[model samples]
Target: MVELTVREALRDAMAEEMRADGDVFLMGEEVAEYQGAYKVSQGLLEEFSPRRVIDTPITEAGFAGIGVGAAMAGLRPIVEFMTFNFAMQAIDQIVNSAAKTSYMSGGLVNVPIVFRGPNGAASRVAAQHSQCYASW
Candidate 1:
């Protein structure tokens, strides 16, 4: 078996997805021009170019909504939230917009987007994970 680090695995997965589908694109804070917040997406911009791997502002809700809309419009999006805390800023978009797009469209439109973010220690909230259960 190939021994790969967590970052390598994630990078490979994203790369594979992007390669398999041209519509699949990743956008979020630091994803491009910064190599990701945790550097997991390092070299992706060079490999996929800036259009596929994009960087955005600190506004999660705005970008999350954009991702959802893009997905509804037939483009696959990979939305990175940076962390659960950051995701909190887009909880409504994730739940209401992305999650319910198909239902709201009468089972017609499909929001084929992937939502990603850091977990556990990234949040730095020890023993407070359960508090996010309801929000998630």
Candidate 2:
């Protein structure tokens, strides 16, 4: 068996998927030039270019809504938040729009998107960043 950190595993999986499908792209804050907030997306920008590996502003809802829209248009989007706590800012886009659109459209619209990020507590982080929102 091969051992890999969570970051490496995620990067490898995304890279594999992107290599297999042209529509698979990754988007999030600092995922490109910054190599991800936790370095999980290291080297993806160089391999996929800015077109596939995109960096967005701090507005989570904005980018997430874009991801959902792209998914509805037949693109597979991977959205990475800096932390799951911040994902609350985009909850409407994730839960209401992306999660509900397929049923709302009677299976005519399919949202193929993935939202990924670190979650729960960590050492020396701010209080707001330390709370676990995964179970909520």
Candidate 3:
């Protein structure tokens, strides 16, 4: 058995999927040059190049919407939000667009994408950044 950290596990998953299928790619902020906020995509840009591993701007809503569009168009895009707190800006894209597209389209479209990142509070992050709204 290979032991891996959460970041390493996520990186491996992305790499393996991208290698197995050319349609799979990753997109999000800090996912390329910075190697991801938590380094979950470390070394991926080096292997897959910028075309498959896109480091988008800080516009979460824009990038998230783009990812949903890419998914609906038959490409498998993995979207990272840095943290769930920031993802709130793209909730409409996720819930109304990505989540409802397949059902609304009667399976005509498939959103085989994954939106992942750290959720909930971390130590010393304080109220603004540490708030946990899992129940909300």
The 0-to-1 C-alpha lDDT of every candidate, in the order given, reads: 0.86, 0.95, 0.87
Model 3 — TM-score against the truth?
0.92
lDDT of 2 by residue, 7-33 (tens): 999999999999999999999999999
Give the better candidate number (1 or 3) by TM-score: 3
Return the candidate ranking by lDDT, descending. 2, 3, 1
Report the C-alpha lDDT of model 1 over 34-78, residue by residue, as the tens digit. Answer: 888888798889999998999999999999999999998999999
> Which of 2 and 3 is ahead in lDDT?
2
Q: List the residue pairs that clash in candidate 2.
A: none
**Model 3 pairs in collision:** none
Cα displacement (angstroms), candidate 3, residue 125, comes to 3.0
Estimate, for each residue in 16-122, the C-alpha lDDT of model 3 and write its tens digit.
99999999999998999999987889999999999999988888889999999999888999998877688888999989998998899999998887887777778
Of the candidates shown, which would achieve the greatest lDDT relative to the real structure? 2
RMSD values, in order shown: 2.8, 0.8, 1.5
